[model samples]
Target: MQITGYKSQGVAAAVDLVNAVTTVEGDASFAALREILRVNGFFWHEFEERDAEPLRRWGRTLREFFDAAELETAVSLLNELMLELPMHPHLADHDPHGLHLHFAPPTARLPHRFRASTLMQLSELVVQHGLGRTGTCAAEGCDRVYADTSRAGRRRFCSEACANRTNVAAFRARRRTPRTPEGTG
Candidate 1:
């Protein structure tokens, strides 16, 4: 399934938050959190000091969602969140991105809006591609998560660095292992 930039940002933002909160201990500082929002189109000015801890906690919750081993488990988690978060989905023509779906009403607090956006984006992802587009990083010792937003959907690592690190390790390991004689039975 093709993922538009509109859907991808929220999902990518969720992944970024999860990695910030989980992959690096003590990394989800307010400034760092605000930058995540800015990078994802949430706008740093929209961020409040009060929003940090909640976004951190939400990041942890989303990590659980990405870590789920079964479709039923992931769906159940999302359903529980949907029951809790207020979502007022509507059409909007907004600055930057024009004519797109807005998951939260304009009056909602930024944290609430962030929650609503990430939740609905994830729900849409599950609907379109199940668990195929999200995963834990394949690199050993890495706890980061990733959401594949590209049309190819072939991603297995959270970043290009992780991909290169893992690939280099695999290549070196193969080179070090003794190859059996071609005629050996």
Candidate 2:
């Protein structure tokens, strides 16, 4: 249940990207994407208008990781994506983060850097935890992805709102169900 600091951040970023892209009201705008990266702590020098499409495609691929029904399947998908992506792993001591890994080269473009870092971090998370820790929300009509970093690993919704909604629905359903009186029925 204890995810490493950087890995935890990476998983959050990955889930955020997937949810941002796969949601029914997904905003694929450049500004939104930039905000996601910035909030995720991506150390990018610049973001270009041309980077949107590639980033969107990467988000879609990350979404597929949650679609996996099993941990092995998710690992396979991660492996495939790592193979397809162009990453050059190296160590860096930039911005007072103090000696962390960078998957893409310093000269790489924004999309490439984001892709490499997100994918590599998520892969590490899958190895440490399991594919079960990542999934789409179980609430009806809500398809947002989430990373279950809970101690019990029982999280099934993207947010408290979705979880509360589902719990309320279930409560209402149980209340509506007819009960047998003293086993007479």
Candidate 3:
């Protein structure tokens, strides 16, 4: 729940995977998937062709949490996955992230490791913050999702581009609206 830096990687990797597989413009190709793992500090080298279907399917399934509109709905989905996944929680020490918890068993394959980590981290996030820290992007036409693991956790959009676009649109809308004179009814 107190995850920070790379220690909070599962949250980020979940977001990335969800976006990659769920967004219309996303690249869910094999290479793209591998890059996502590498960028998120997962074991990209171990990724196999056999892992693709499950990982892609997991992304589709995990997107439900981000799309959930109620705490009960999100909690139910996460709980179901938690019960299904085979988790073996243990401590690990490694570069770029020091000591932290690893949820998957040591012998688990890359995709299963990903699923366990993401599922546990997401469960922890929901437990700590309910639905406040993850959601679909607020931009008008974006389908991407996001998870906010930062201390402030004030995020609402998935990216700065969407944020800036929305802000600029709002500014233009406000400027276009004719304001009544001061004190006018």
Candidate 4:
């Protein structure tokens, strides 16, 4: 895939993974982690007993990207992460999807790979599209994070359901508004 395609995919996967970690209840079990990794195109192997902590830390860092108060703040946070958790970039074709760039070394641990790839991709995305592309849902009572990949870059909600619900609520509120006493004025 093209670099932009790869970056977009990575941002999407990162968002999904972060959201799952933050929104999902219960402890981060091996099965849950495996499922999240699988959905994000990461191959899951037999996880070590201590793997959950690193994954949680990674998720916390990823969540910070979305929770940033402004674009510059988000960029700064990402840069700080890049400096703290460096990734050794090297070419590899381990996947059947064909040759693509890999950020971490082949022997890196799963948490390291997850952190490196997602953070690198997120940095590229922010550099290419600005930190405004990442945001929380605008719908009431829904704070899910989403990567705004639309061409127009006007996305406001995390999902269509939230958008629809917000719209419907607004329409109902407008209809219920009282407008009268014009002639008395």
TM-score of each predicted structure versus truth: 0.95, 0.91, 0.95, 0.85
- Model 2 worst lDDT run, 10 consecutive residues: 1-10
Instruction: Give candidate 1 regions above 4 Å deviation.
Output: none
Q: Worst lDDT window (10 residues) for model 1?
A: 1-10
TM-score of 2: 0.91
lDDT per model, in order?
A: 0.88, 0.83, 0.90, 0.77
lDDT of 4 by residue, 1-185 (tens): 22255556667767776776776433356677777677667756645657767887787778888988788888889889889986899887765557677788878888888888888888877777776678888988886888886577888888899999999999999989887778965
Position 23, candidate 4: lDDT: 60
- Residues 63-171 of candidate 1: C-alpha lDDT, one tens digit per residue: 9899988999999999999999878898988887888888899888898889998998888898988898898989998888998877788899988999999999999
Over the stretch 1-185, how does candidate 2's per-residue lDDT look in tens digits? 34666656767877877877888977878888878887878753387789888988888988889888898889899999899998898999876467888889989888888888888888877877787788888999998989886668888899999999999999999999988899696
Cα deviation of 162 in candidate 3 (Å)?
A: 0.4
Colliding pairs, model 1: none
Clashing pairs in 4: none
The best candidate by lDDT is 3
* Prediction 3 global C-alpha lDDT: 0.90
Listed per candidate, the RMSD to the true structure in angstroms reads 1.4, 2.0, 1.3, 2.7
